[model samples]
Target chain A: MKARVTVTLKTGILDPQGKAIEGALKSLGVAGIASVRQGKVFDIELAGADPAQAEAALKDAADKLLANTVIENYNIEVRS
Target chain B: MKARVTVTLKTGILDPQGKAIEGALKSLGVAGIASVRQGKVFDIELAGADPAQAEAALKDAADKLLANTVIENYNIEVRS
Candidate 1:
């Protein structure tokens, strides 16, 4: 099974990297870009066959190590 | 309009960050995790209503700034 974890900054958090990206895009002559929010993605391969178990384990992983729950939110997707 | 860009390391690339994440997950007692790959995601808001134009601009941004074309692949999704 494969689990994808997306960890994104919560609304109202300041993202310096995103701001830098927005500026870079503008300097690159890309127009109409208003804002950018940067995040992290983790693609994990598991040795399990049970989708439910994999999802649960990934969620645990996200909560424990993959995300800063105070400032970020994480979503998990499982594929088998 | 909104565009989401995902930047991932190419296959066979050494990802020290991903390796560290894998070790962290194991230390956190999360089982069944075989391997981990880390990537970046950017959620971009654009000032245009045209999906086609937004997609093109985002692709350009990805190629120029969001991704390293030599070692990373990027995927863009546009929403309106």
Candidate 2:
């Protein structure tokens, strides 16, 4: 199985890096940009486990390497 | 309007940071024993623009700052 994890900053957090990127975009003659926030994604390959088992494993992965829950939120999707 | 941009390492790109995170996770005893890949996301708020216009702006953002297209790919989602 394969799992895709998306990690995003929590609302209300100050995203300086994202803002910097937005600014850079505007300077590059890329108009219409209003704002920007940032996040992460993880694509993992599992050991051909069942969906439930995969979910459990993925949760473990999230708690460990995928996210810092204090500042970020993560969502996981599993595919065969 | 708001736009979400997810930037991920292209397949076949070596992700040392992701590997390091995986190792850290394992040492933390949070084991699923899987591989890890890392990516980035950007959430943007527009100036009350339509989805189509927002998408154009987002593309510019991605091209300029949100992603290093040499190794990263981005997807944009617009929400009102």
Please provide, for model 2 over A1-80, each residue's C-alpha lDDT reduced to its tens digit, 9 standing for 90 to 100: 78898888888989898888777877788877777777878888777579888888888878766789999898989988
Writing each residue's lDDT as its tens digit, candidate 1 over B2-78 gives: 77899999999999999999999888899999999999999999999999888988988998899999999999988
| lDDT for predicted candidate 2 compared with the true structure | 0.81
* First chain of candidate 2, TM-score: 0.94
Per residue, candidate 1 scores C-alpha lDDT tens digits across A18-79 of 99989988988999999999999999999989999999899999998889999999999887
DockQ (C-alpha based) per candidate is 0.93, 0.68
> What is the lDDT of every predicted structure here?
0.93, 0.81
| Candidate 2 TM-score, true structure as reference | 0.87
> CAPRI verdict on model 2?
medium
By lDDT, who's the top model here?
A: 1
Which residue runs does candidate 2 get wrong by more than 4 Å? none
Clashes of 1: 0
